[model samples]
Each structure stands twice: as structure tokens, then as C-alpha cells.
Target: MSSAPKNEIFTQVVLEVFKVGGLLNIDGDKLTKEFGLTASRWKILGAIMLSDNPVTVPEIGRYMGQSRQAVQRLVDVMAKDGLLTMTENPNHKRAKYIQMTTKAVDIYKQLDMKQVKWAEGLSSDLSTSEMESALKVLKHIAKQISA
Candidate 1:
């Protein structure tokens, strides 16, 4: 067989990154399940919590890089579960703004605590400076890939 191309190394790196991301997600999902939340629903709750203003479903979809319908479904389920509330959007008659409920807010706080512990365990050996540098490099790579 012919020798592998130089670009194959980059491809292999990307694949490994995705593989690790998937593993992280699986662990996250297990944690979320303990709170009676799915991975996607927890992600929506997180987005809402991080936003200072009410976020539209479409805006959430765009931020999460998911389809609008998929985000809407998550919103609907959360609303039904009393985890979120939907308000009419004045800017868009058809669109609704989503906000987390008090229950969700409380749960999010618990999740945050768990996440802190998880981070501590995962980076037990890494210094803050190392973590910062890693974050910077990942951010740069994300920007380049998105661009």
C-alpha cells in the first residue's frame, strides 16, 4: 500500500478529539440522568441560565448548533416538566422567549456543584495556568475550524 499522506495526521487528531468529546458527553449524560434530565435538555437549561436576557428558541438552536425544531422540542419538554417557562416574543409574534423556572434554577445550582467537583477530579494534576493555556488553544482551534 502507498504511504499515508501528511494531512492524515491532522485528520487522526480531529478524530481523536471527537472521540474524547463523545466520551465526555456520555459521562455528562449519566450525571444529568441522575437529575431526571437528558443531555440536550440540560444543555438548554444551561444556555438559559447563562443568558442575562430571555433567549428565543431559534437563538438557542443557533448557539447550540442544533436544528430549530430540535431545540423547540427540548423547550416544549422542559416547559411541560415545569423546568422552564415560555413567554411571548414581542419582536417575533411566532417566536417565544425561554426562561428557566425556579425549580430549574435550583437544580442548575446543584449541577454546578457537581460540575465543579467533576472539573476538580478531571484536572487534579493540572495547574490553573495549564488549564488556561489549554482553553486558549482550544478556543483558537474552534475559531479556526468555524471560520
Candidate 2:
């Protein structure tokens, strides 16, 4: 017996998703370039800011679908640069709580505003319902893959 033909349409859509991810990274780098931030740094910083409290490097890795070692390397460098601070975690002796410094908060706020405006401009020609549907579909796909 032979397997059925592959889903060409789904494959094409998946490829588009990959392409869009690359474009988003490029645009993110451009937005953060003036703030002395790269796409990687901005993502990690944004993760901490969005958490609204201290989190561990492992937590950030899980949230971003990255490796804990990769997050640790970035966190260590950021801490040295004074953008991140480490506090003792009562629950885990080895896992320190990570938080953004005041300076990093200021930069994050500025970038957040820029990101809002950029998103607005990009979605201006699109319908809100369409955007919502697209977001739902993309998130569903992500959830499926991660599961």
C-alpha cells in the first residue's frame, strides 16, 4: 500500500509562517537597534517585563520555546550589562529570580510604544475580525506543535 499525497496547501501555509517569522525578527531588530537591543535581547527583556514579576531563566526558556542554557547565557550577559538583576529564589536554591533593571524598564517602555504603533500601522488595512481569526489559527498551530 502507498500513502496518500501530502497536504500541499498546509505545507505552503507552514512555509509562509516561517517566512513571516523571519520578517518579524528583522523588523524587531530594526525597531530595537537604536535602543542598543537586538532581537534576542528584546525578546528576553520583553518576556521578563510581560511576566510583571521576577522569573527564572528556565521559566523564560520554557515561555519562549528556547533552551535553558541559551537563556542562561543571555541572562548572564544581560546581568553584566546592568539590564537584568538576579535575586534569590526561596523555592529553588539554584534558580535565581530574574528581573529587569530600571534602565531596562525605561527602554522596554519606549520599545513597547513603538511596537504598538508599528502593529497598528501594519494592521491598518486589515479587518479586526480577520486579524483575530489569523491570530487564533496561528496560536492553535503553535499549541498543537508544542503538544
Candidate 3:
């Protein structure tokens, strides 16, 4: 019988990651659906909310590891829905700054509360330190991958 290559270990890890990612995506979708939002839209809103200043579509896209065009489409949809507004960007005439509207802020707050509850429910067994450690590990892995 032929032996599996050592690199197969890395391949298996990646496959498992993808599988878990799909499950997480489904859970995220269900959570966003409850707020009448999609995962992409929520991510955009989150990026804006966490930012210290108004951000451009490209900035949000880069932060989310998505394409500019994809982020622009979401920006357009949200703008049309009165969830966000696009203002002129002095830094880049070609790019517009995105800002959340009051209604969007309200929705975001509600979603934030719901997210907290969901996390609490899901992580009832995990201590706060454990969660922090997991986050730190994930961030480290993400930085390594990006590098």
C-alpha cells in the first residue's frame, strides 16, 4: 500500500477548515437573516462601525478580504435601501466615503445585542480567557496567512 505524503496533513487541515467555515457561514447567514440583512451587508456595516473614520468602498473591501466591485455593489444596495450614504471623498475623487444612516445605526445596535446573546449561548461552556485565547490564535493565523 502506498503511504500518504506528509503534505497531505496540511491538505486535510485546509479541508477541515473549509468544512467548518461553511457551517459558520450558515450560522452567520441565519443570524443576519433575522435582522433582514445578508452576511456581506452585515460585514460592510461592521467595518464602517469599527472604523475610526469614514471609509471608502475599497477600504471596506480590503478589510473584508473582498473585491472592490463586490463591496461597491453592496454599498449601492445599502445606499438605495437608506441604510448608508455616500459622500465625496476628498482623498480620492473617484471613491466616495460611506457612512451609516441613523436607521442603520439602530439596526446595527439591535444586531449587536443579538450577536452578544448568540455568542453567549454558543460559548456557555467556554471561559472568557478561553475565548480570548481562541481569538488571539485566529488573529495570529490570519496575520501569518496574509503575510
Give each model's whole-structure lDDT.
0.86, 0.91, 0.88
Best by TM-score: 2
Model 2: lDDT to the true structure:
0.91
Cα lDDT over the full model 1: 0.86
The digit string of per-residue lDDT tens for model 1 on 16-46 reads 8789888887888987888899778878988
Best by lDDT: 2
RMSD after Cα superposition, model 1 = 3.4
TM-score of 1: 0.85
Error of 2 at 15 (Å): 1.2
Per-residue CA lDDT of candidate 2, range 1-147, in tens?
435455766687799998998999999999999998888899999889889667999999988889999999999998998999999999999999999999999999999999999999999999999999999988998899989
Clashes of each: 0, 0, 0
Off by over 4 Å in 1: 1-9
lDDT of 1 at 140: 86
